[model samples]
Target chain A: MIGTWTLFQRESRRFLRVKMQTIVAPALTAILYLIVFRYAMGDRQVPGLDVDYFSFLIPGLMMMAMLQNAFANTSSSMIVGKIMNVHVFLLMSPISAAEAVFAFLAAAVLRALVVGSVLLLVLLPFSDLSLAHIWMILFYGVCGSLIMGSLGLIGGMWSKTFDDMAMVNNFIIMPLTFLSGVFYSVSQLPPFWQAINAWNPFFYLIDGFRHGFIATGDSDPLQAMGAVAILTILAVLSAWYLWRIGWKLKE
Target chain B: MNALEINNLYKVYGNGNVALQDVSLLVPEGSFFALLGPNGAGKSTLINILADTVNASSGSVSLLGHDLFHERAWCKRRMGVVPQEIAFDPFFSPREVLKFSRGMYGQKADDAWVDELLERLELTQHAHKITRQLSGGMRRRLLVAQALVHRPKLVILDEPTAGVDVELRKRLWDFMRELNAAGTTILLTTHYLEEAEELCDQVAIIDQGKLITSRPMKELIREVASSSLCLRYAEPLQLSDEDKSILSAFSPRVYDNQLCLTLNKQDSRSDFDTVYQAAKQRFGTPVDVSIRQEDLEDVFLRLTGDSS
Candidate 1:
């Protein structure tokens, strides 16, 4: 247990040591996003909802930022370890593989939540944000980060270089988050696009989390909650299996 | 019981490189042992397997009476390895690295021990500085300290003084000797034959994924000494191509102006008389001749057949 805690503490401090790049940069990016969106849609109202555009947009942005940072934390930590060959220290320690997996996922989840809180506190004054279903908000906020963090662990284990990690972030994660109805309502899109969004796991994360703030979105909150929970289980399990098998970790 | 024991160890990497082939070794408890090998001779592979960073293809290792793989956690608690690569988290200070390593191995925080390690390693001034800010030698010393933080019973130093200055090397050895004197078993791997000869009581040399020899240093030197022969001429010797070619068949070498060769068999007096006749023709009367005791470098070259 001490080994696990030390691993977790070390990983957490690794990112926290670079607060300017890990925490502040993401929050700053979120504020810039808010400013641009607020000016671009001055008088727009979300479709079939009484809330203004920024109200509907803020929750999605916050969740997206949280998820992105969560993935980045684990992936970057792993790639740096591999490139520097410092991972041998962890491998040689008395900690078990299961403990290592848990430590990394826990640290990645913490980074996600920290980034989300900073984004929320920074953008609170600019947007009309209120918590309608606080329980749902907390649920999706944590589960979403876990899911992303698990994926990040997998990506980090598989990536051999920085460019490989970038490919995952740019080609896979960027498309999923953007198409998950972060900026606009999925109901306004054509039926074909709505079906595509339904298949995206990020849609469940974003739509379920947005439902917590406004209690309104293009999808039902209950179903999204169930879907996100299932995906969370799958993600965490995959990460654990990869770790146990030592895929790309042990030779 | 031996501090470490290996039986029929082998490692075929994912790329199908046979790094270790049926290699076996045993290191006695509380003894300073040296593992020597030529480049790409599987020294690092063997160490990595014991360190738990690389899995063996077919082998079993026992460390301090615990199975290295099946009971890895138990063994790891009592072992520390200073790897060949210089690796550290740039954001972390040396102090943090040491404390964190001890904690990772399930040891409680011991500030006194940590401070002592820092001071002994001459890293106290840079203890709080980021890893990149320190010099390469400092990082190497920090690696040594990091491995010793948990005070493992068996410590492996893999080329720990590769790039270190001579003064720092002396200091590192002094600290290591102190630990060894206090009952720590150190297994060191180095390319410097003199370093091994000067320090280690036991030595093992491997090459081409095979173990050539593993024995007590004094015993091996004595065995090589009996097989060594040197013929000295009356003057600074010069040999023609024909004469040198005939002497070459005797595995000849010139060391300290003396023609040196090893007597391979138990009965090589006939071979000795042949050398006397050949060298006597080329360089006049033999002034002095005696049995030449070979050093560690000669033994290594004779076994591995690697001149360079």
Candidate 2:
């Protein structure tokens, strides 16, 4: 635990010192999405959401920041280490796989929170958002970040070249998060699209996040929470298993 | 007890290339052991296995009586490694880099010791400079200082001096010797035979993923006593028919204004006397002869074949 905390602190220090890359960059992305989406659909209101389009977009924007920052934290960290050959520093240490996973995930989640909080604060002045259920917001936000962070770690570990990592981000992660009904409710979609969204784990993340904005959701909160719990467990398990095997790292 | 031992290690990559093949060796306690090999000879694989950065396909390794796999955590804490490549977080200063590395090893912060390492490696002046901006030699020194941050009992350096200039290489060697004298067993791999010959008491050679030979440096040197003799002639001495007939006996070659000979492995005393006598008779005056005793390079070439 001490070892994990030490690594976590080091990672935090690295990100903090380079705030433009870790904080300002992600916040800028959130602001861009806000300007574009708010202009395109500002006055429109969804049937069951009980808010303007910007309010709905705020949750999605927060979730986007959470996901992207989580992915960037681990992927950038590992890939940079691999490229610089400084990975030897970590590889030669006494830190175990468990400690490594803990450290990386912790740092990723922290970045997610920082970025998410900034988006929320910046958008708060422009909208009338109720603090309907802060607990649920925190829960799903943290869980969504963990899932993406763990996925980033798996991507970083399995990639031998930078191109492999870039491929994972562009081809898999981006498409899923964008098409997961972040802007509109899945209930309005046709049967085929709804079926696809049902299988998407990101759909559940946004659905759970939107739940915190209102008292109820189009889907059951319990179901989305269950999905997140299961995904988080799988991410932790896969990371732990990879570490034990020393998968790409050892050989 | 051996400070490090490997028995029948094997590593077959997923792509079906064999990286290590039935390799095994022992590093006795408190001795500087050099694992010498060619470019693709599995030196990195062997080192990675001990460091737990690479898993072996089969067999076992132990460090200070601790199993490398089963007791990996404890074994890891007892060893340090300086990898051949200079890997660093470019954004960090030398001090931050060392502090982070020390923390990763599960050690308490020792500012004085870390500062001393930076000082010894001649990096104290650049402690606050970001790593990416440092020159190649400074980067190499930073690698060495990072490896020693945790104060492990055994330190392994894999080609730590590959591209370093002569002055820095000598400083690295001196620091390594000091560590060895202080009872930190040093294990290294190098292409520089002179470095291995001068520093390592025990030497192991690997080729094509297999262990070629392991012996004391002195014994290996002594085993290859086909002394190299270079003769500078006053005028180019033409090889007479008689000299040509016996030339194969000495493995002679002529270049520019000199003749070089590698006497047969088991050259008879009479053979050397004959070559000297023939040279004098053919040239009508004795040539200036310089005899150099066999060294590790000779043994290395003999066992691995000469490329240089």
Candidate 3:
């Protein structure tokens, strides 16, 4: 447990040491997103959410920040350490596989929450968000962070170059984030697009998390929570298994 | 008890490159051992395996009487590794790095120990500086400090002085000697044969991923029974056929008006004496003459076929 905490400490310290890239940059980007969307689509309401566009958009954007930051935290750290060979400390440490995986995920979740909080704080005055259901908000935020952080770790292990990491960011994570009803409501989409969104697990993450803020969601909150919970365990377990087997990490 | 014992260790990388091949070694407790090898001879691979950075394809490594593969956590807590590469995290200061390493090694935080390590390694002045602000030698010293932070029973140092200066090297060795005297087993790999000859009592040579020889330092040096006579003059010696014939017996080579002649085999006293008289007769009153006994460098080159 001490080992895990130490690793977690190092991870958070690493991110905190570079606040510009890890925290401030994401916060700035979120603020910019709000400004641009609010001006471009002034005073609009979602087709079915019946909520002001900014109010509906705030929680979704927070979830986006949560997911992206969580993913970026672990992926960037892993890839940089692997490339620079400083990960020798990690490999040579006595920390167990579970401990290592949990540390990375824990730090990721911590960063995600931090970035999400900053977004919420900055965007609060602009929207009429209820900020309801605090339990659901914390639950979905943590779940999303864990899942994205796990993916990031796995991707980092699989990547050999920054370009490879970018491929994941550009082709997969970006597409998923933008297409997951983050800026608009899923009910407004056509049947085919809705079906496609149903397949994207990210949509469930955003819907469940947004429902926490406004009690408005396209899917059953209970079902989405269950799916996210299972995915979180599976993702974290996959990370642990990789570390245990020394997959592209040890040798 | 042996500090570390490996039996039939073999590692074939994922790309089918064999890094280690049936290599076995024993490092007795409190012994200063050297694992000498040329480049690409699997020295780093072996050390990495012990450090748990590289997994052995097949082998059993007993570290501090614990099975490394079965009780890795136990082994890791008792061993520290100084790898060949110079890698440090840019985010952390030297002090944080040491604290983090101690924690990673399953040791409680000890500021006194950390302070002692910093002062010993001459890194106290740079403890709060970010890693990027440190010089190469300073970074290397920090690596040494990090490896020693946990005060492990066995420490593996892989070419720790590769780029360090003469002064730091001296200080580093003194610190290492102190650790060794305190009963900490040390496993070292170095290209500097003279340093190895001076420090290590047990020597092992690996070439082309196979152990060529492992022996006591004295015994290994004794096996290469050879000597060289070096002759120098104010003017280069112009050798005729007769001079060539007499000097050829010693396999002479000239460099900057100096003649270095080697007697390949040293066991025969009469042979050396006869050649000495012949060379003396051929080159009369040379400016200076000196003989050097064969050392570890000669033994290493000869046994490894001088492949490096």
Worst lDDT run of 10 residues, candidate 2 chain B, spans: B263-272
lDDT of 2 by residue, B1-308 (tens): 88988899899987899988998888999999999888888999888878767768899888999888888778888888888777778878999888888888788889999999998999999999999889988988888898899898899998899788999899889999999999999999998889899999999999889999987878877776568666888776555567656765665555556665665444435356666665566555545787766577766765664333
Judged by DockQ, which candidate is best?
A: 1
Q: Tens-digit lDDT track for model 3 on A1-251?
A: 77898899999998988999888898898889888998988998788766888888889988998999999999999999988788888988899998999899999999999999888888888767897788999999999999999999999998989999999999999899888999988898999998888989999999889989998778888878888899999999999899789888877
The DockQ of predicted model 3 stands at: 0.72
Instruction: Score every model by TM-score.
Output: 0.92, 0.89, 0.91
Q: What C-alpha lDDT values do all the predictions have? A: 0.87, 0.82, 0.88
TM-score of 1: 0.92
Candidate 3 per-residue lDDT, tens place, B172-221, comes to 99999999999999999999999999999898999888988888887887
TM-score of chain A of each: 0.97, 0.95, 0.97
Candidate 3: which stretches are off by over 4 Å?
A: B228-270, B273-291
Q: Comparing candidate 1 with candidate 3, which one achieves the higher TM-score? A: 1
Q: Write candidate 1's Cα lDDT for B1-308 as tens digits.
A: 89999999999998889999999999999989999989999999999999988889998999988889899999999999999999988879999999899999998899999999999999999999999899999999999999999999999999999999999998899888889999999999998889888888899999989999999999888877545567876555455577668767656666546776666553533466666676677666767888765788888877786533
Over 4 Å off, model 1: B226-260, B263-273, B278-292
Clashing pairs in 3: none
